[model samples]
Target chain A: MKQYQRSSILVIGGAEDKVHGKEILQSFWHCAGGTSAIIGIIPSASREPTIIGERYFNIFRDMGAKDIRVLDVRDRIHGEDKGYQEYVEECTGIFMTGGDQLRLCGLLADTPLMERIRQRVKLGEVTLAGTSAGAAVMGHHMIAGGSSGESPNRALVDMAMGLGIIPEVIVDQHFHNRNRMARLLSAISSHPERLGIGIDEDTCAVFHHHNEFIEVLGRGTVTIVDAQAMSYTNQGDVSAEAPLALHNLRLHILGHGDRYNIKNHQPIAAVVE
Target chain B: MKQYQRSSILVIGGAEDKVHGKEILQSFWHCAGGTSAIIGIIPSASREPTIIGERYFNIFRDMGAKDIRVLDVRDRIHGEDKGYQEYVEECTGIFMTGGDQLRLCGLLADTPLMERIRQRVKLGEVTLAGTSAGAAVMGHHMIAGGSSGESPNRALVDMAMGLGIIPEVIVDQHFHNRNRMARLLSAISSHPERLGIGIDEDTCAVFHHHNEFIEVLGRGTVTIVDAQAMSYTNQGDVSAEAPLALHNLRLHILGHGDRYNIKNHQPIAAVVE
Candidate 1:
């Protein structure tokens, strides 16, 4: 038996070398439930989804994923792939490759692929792993980058729907290097009740169903923006030609090796729920 | 007459103390070219736009806006005041009072009010300014939040439309305190050729004509992320869920009292074309 009753799921932001790939693979392979393989991705939005395609295959191969397939269905309008059934059936674990999250969400929204992934995670028999864009789209809400810090104007800034694997949490990748913290803070400030998670380049944070949190191999820290207790008004519904005002907003930051049990949606002690 | 032509606009972000009743009043009296008035915002998506409403009216009135009027257009659908025409025609400058950006965007997206304002700025007959949410929307692209930096999976997090005043520039207000440098960098990385400008709190960078730039009063520095001459692929368009690899991205930082000119889309010394 594994520590989590449900299938193991590993969510990662991009920069694989920093994401502790080797450590995660070892742990998933050791799961006694016998894992299979399923790969989810926003394939069409990326210019090189095939870049690490072979590495993922190799990892899953070592994890006993005899059959591995990458779904490149950019849209339902394009239809599904051929071996999706076998991949889903034998899927002891599902992996999501990181790329362009917008591209991923574009494909998964109201599509059969997203529906299937939701069902698998619900069944808790499969493991889920995603990196970079893959990890971003897994959550209910995700960060869409906006204008430069030079201008405070918030136009053309929109949010795309996601797989909803994790609700009330918005995620971003390439954090510090990209300096996306302000964008994330503005994001959570728009919705004070939500929590924003930012995994640094090449880092991974795993949340288990049994209430355990583990920091995979990576050099960067995870930045969490929790506006649960704060109050803000983004004027999101206001006209774009006007100024927006916000008041009384607060945030909390979390790091790797930290545990935030989702059951209650608050920062908790570093212990299994 | 104004120095810069249309097709490009400068957007200002917000801060609380910057709106000291006496100072804003002076700005209008000394710097403003025409009659000024204050606009009040009502409830929309977030907090009340009232705080800023009072602040603007008080400041404008104190600054010799004897013809000043508070167009309390809180609810666009239901509460747009009727006395806008006189003010619009008579005023030399337009100040977008602070409120929830969503509400402002909603009320002004297709209304005659936005049309007039756009026309005024296009003709260089009036200056447009905003704070906070008002500032976020003045870009060719807006962040619309939803960007979770935790992972690159959700890169296309979410986006909303803007006034389309400023081209190729995405603005962020209240920068350093919130750490949005990364988000801006991520945004710039998406379009390596584009420029990302992050304005610190209480700071304003005014873009005059097509080539002139000036920094305004503020405590923090302005950040710019320029990604030209960089190599990145498999981003926003990947074949699968692979970690998008970005190579050779460069960043620039600008602070107060610093000015630069954009000649042929490149930042250089302010000069006459």
Candidate 2:
């Protein structure tokens, strides 16, 4: 339970525009201090770990990161390798690719590599960026599984422990494109103490100043579900499989250039010229 | 966030045998210092708060409690009333009735009354007991709502803030009778950091000595879902609404006279004479 004091995180909704311009990836690179950065690509979440690792390696190299290495952690054994630990220790930026979130946790959670990554991020020496499943693992309360298009219902989503880089929030990737509102709403309704963030495709929510405010970037919207002020829900009285009824759920949809204040639970309007 | 250093709590599953033997209620009374105890019945969870309050009032009185008062917190305004605050402050024991957990939270959460109750409990001056919906609100990660019968799935259960008397454990009531194992499993899978306790009907899990160990009483069993050592879960790769696949989920069933150690995540065998 190492508390992150001054870490900067980029949680991208899945399907980031890698082909067109790779702007979200570029933003992550810039935040990592541009050409001076030593980047590490952790592709443990992907089934084809080496392939995805090379994918990110090339991307970061093409963006002028002189030193970029892919740490292919295929299992617990690889996660325990000292060489990978050294890579994590030396890297200024760590990028986690989109794939299976549980794969990421199963391989890296509680391992030495995970510890080093957390330590570096906590000391403000690293900028961690994750997309899709990578993004989902950023929060402690990760939305591991759930369906789209359905209204809020009991047992609509399944959860698993995440990497815990962000403790107070639950992250959902491929949000609007998959119609994940019902599931994310259900998630926050259950755990109102933690903020629910739904990041859409091609978008990224940059948590700056130790996660105080998140700046939204990319083509899609970031939906924030805050149930702190919620008044009522029929969760107990209703039968299993019944549609959920929640009241006073506060939602904020922010797109490119917009910002959201996590502490205040309000949206920050973009400054006008 | 006042943590309870040395508090005693009695979390009962629904349908306790109040008329036949009244063993569970008697246990709660005995733990509250017997005859000299002044118990405050918070019937905010019940729809007919006054009627349900009086029912418990008679029950406690018949159990030979000298002073029993019903704190009718109908709304947030009533929760702020000075008279109610005094009642909560002076009471030696507090009992929350079973009904709608959300109704209880909606009326009392963050109110002056809740603050006083929390303070009293934290100082080890009050014995907090709840049944059914009452039991659900004992933990910070309260299982606000979820469906039964279905296999573990995404968004199967809903959560909200609870009284925080038991911060580390998630309490589920009417465990076996309603078949709530699936939802509780789903809950622990998502938040492995917290322990999930599912209490069966007519049974009560008594957490004494500052929640070091839980003593089981009554007829049914208390199911403990410990996912701390879980090896894997299909939560990330499975589609929404698909049956959840989890491996290495440790479960313990405790009946009368059994004890469970929370810190060690193991059951202590009952001593034989």
Candidate 3:
């Protein structure tokens, strides 16, 4: 018999307006199982880990997460420290701060602490959430770096290995504000099998039920680029310095309260309430 | 006990100077066991399948292969045709043409014919080679499309499912001339576990001995991006419109007669002629 497991992920685009209303944070809190949740803030992605870690700590604390703590992992050596594994293992919710994604992956991707966190998430023990760089590292095919523009071109994006929390999708933060549509299109164009999620600033995409459905929240839009049916491209014939031209690419724009079905690649309209 | 099998792939960057000396094609022919080879050409990626297929058919024919056939797979349904499976099964070499990679994948991927090709490759029955768009689909992580540029940025490249002939690598064609360095770097940055090979026009990277070593052949250079030890990137913290900044990314450039060790991520210097 196939084993059933529950895993949840919260991917927030950069600059989520925390002071405005905290709707996104509230969604994350609820996904983490509310007041009884024990949250662990992984600030390894941040250059100033302590400062960034404290910010999330206070936010979660104010949101009624009574048992919230920060895990300050500085390097691969620190991530391997057995002392930190227990904290990650004990948490019902794990929140990763926004910073350099490569820093976070470098410090924790192969460590015991990260392994523990992954194991717990696999076993339905925790809800993992990240914002900006933190959110980018949630997927296996991470958008490590890239510039934003209106036109799709070759060599515009960089990809790196992520934590493998979400294996089938690639997440990009601060979508619309930065005009990342071109780059996102480029990413999906190159790897059509993997879904691309462009989370706008102040918005979040909550993936639940084993990542089958993603519920969008907050003030901004979440753009979905599905290149599975992409038909044409001059990628092979065109010169390197020229702009890219692709046809039959599909795009989906979802806003607050909207839900997306990953299995079917369909969008569900939000309830009017 | 583990199963031991033999498989090989020749990925050529686009615009290979087929007319100049046919050095890259010669390498592929040699790998396919020379005159004794029975080759199959899959022109599914081309909109003009017959034209492209016939082009390779003559090339392989002139190269002294007695048995050369084109597998005109029009769609997913045609790929399921039982008659065509025999051509792919009997061939000692299979060459996929350059056009729309998505077209090739759309028609052949997951179909019975594709499965047969994969089975044959795994069983050491055939040598597979592809150029340009053909080459991109050689790996599991396919570069579907992207524009050319000198710098890496977010969403600058797209990735899709390839034929899975090379499971641990991503192949890009027209490396230097197209200025695809940025996109390839982006790919490796996001998925460091997988190696990235950028084949310049007319160059080919031949994977043999169970993909333990890659032999570079052609006039142009092959760029290998190894991201396993990548240390840092400001991918997450920076604005979406900002260009990428990465540190400690390892790059290797190889020319004719140069070989790369996949396991060690090192380049073997070419022997002085």
Candidate 4:
């Protein structure tokens, strides 16, 4: 029930610019404390955690982060180590890379190390950024796997328990790039209480202000599927593969610099300063 | 909440023998009062309700039933007709033919006629038989549409509201012939409270004695998937297309003359007469 009052959670879609501009990652670094940032890279979701961790470590280090460590946890036991917990506790920024979300939850779900990270992130002590698989795990109801380029249906998207970092929303990364709108819509049909957020590749939905608002950053757009006021859905009675029919579902698209009010479920037109 | 204390609800899988043995239909005829039976054929689910309805009416008539009426209700307004309600109320036997479960529900869901039919069935006033689409709509959570021949996942089934004659179960007809075991499993994943019943072609599952017991009659087997004591399922968090993983799901297969306890969720092996 705790809200992110002072914390900044950057939920990035996959395939972020690691080479050139790094505008999205730069925002994360700035929010994470710039040169004074004590950063921790969590590549547990990746198949090759060492390579992924080192890659992120280099990204932050080259961007002027003085204190950085790669918390390459392959197994759940690694999350129990006191040393990792201490490091997570002292970190000003945490970065989670893309890979298998089930593996991510399997290794870090209930570990004390994850708890410490969540606590620091929640207490406004650290800024947390999760891309792809990491972004997928932000919601309480996570989407582990699904297909794209299909009409929304009960069988189009698969879901599982999420990390609950931002419990109110279901986040899907690489949205437009993978043609995943229908997938997200299907996921929302099952759980209408949760807001559906589809962040495009290279894009980021920056949640701030107690998680009440979202600011779109980087290239591409963010699609929001809100079924809070859904009038009807055939999800409960049909078989999984049947095409789902949902009525009165609200949708919003936010491009770069666009702002949204999560509480009100409304889009705010971009302001030119 | 009304238990079927004395009702005989014949849930038939599609392609029940119309020409040769006609065993399933015979059981329905015998249960309906035989020579004294006043049968009403409801072919509202069929694309050509008149053709389907008349076909069933003729079948029942040829089987020695003295009185038979084809209530070919194609529109929802037809369900509001007092004539239809009166006929439904007077009929000692009701037969629902196969086609589209959604169409059937769309026309009859909350109609006075359907209410009357449901009330009569619940009160043990009528012996009702539904085949294929008819069988599918007998449950509270109906498998309106879905695919077969695949692994069980959230996306394999499409469900909708049914007539709910037997509220505790979900029925899928044409089971083994279409390889729909995965489809039924997917449906059960969404609703663990409902008992899943997959009836094979040419088969009938006859419910009797306060809906507490099910007797499998005819040629094929009835597959039952019980998730009441299911220990673990990734259904809650996975995507729709992702293959589902379920643990501790109880399964039972019953052939001709096999009896099963619906209340206890157990199979009573076929008794040697």
Using TM-score as the measure, the top candidate is 4
lDDT of 1 at B154: 25
Global local distance difference test of model 2: 0.77
Candidate 1: stretches off by over 4 Å = A1-6, A18-21, A24-45, A62-65, A74-82, A150-153, A210-217, A234-250, A269-273, B1-273
- Candidate 2, residue A204: CA error in Å? 0.4
Error of 3 at A232 (Å): 41
The model with the greatest DockQ is 1
Taken over the whole model, the C-alpha lDDT of each candidate is 0.53, 0.77, 0.75, 0.81
Better of 1 and 3 by lDDT: 3
The model with the greater TM-score, 3 or 4, is 4
iRMS of each prediction in angstroms?
13.3, 17.7, 15.9, 18.0
For candidate 4, lDDT tens digit of each residue in A60-179? Answer: 999999699988889899999888888887788999999999999999998999988888888878999999999999999999998853335667788999999999999988875565
Q: Residue-wise lDDT of candidate 2 within B126-211, one digit each (tens)?
A: 88889998999888888889875343566778878887878899999887556566678667766777988988778888887778
Query: Per-residue lDDT of B158-209 in model 1, one digit per residue for the tens?
Result: 4466666665667766665455554554455455555566676665656666
Model 4 lDDT, residue A88, Cα: 81
Candidate 2 chain B worst ten-residue window by lDDT:
B1-10
- Per-model TM-score (chain A alone): 0.77, 0.94, 0.93, 0.96
User: Candidate 3: where are CA atoms >4 Å away?
Assistant: A1-273, B1-7, B236-242
lDDT for B212 in candidate 2 is 86
Task: Mark the regions of model 4 whose C-alpha exceeds 4 Å error after superposition.
Answer: A1-6, B1-273
Worst 10 residues of 2 chain A by lDDT: A1-10
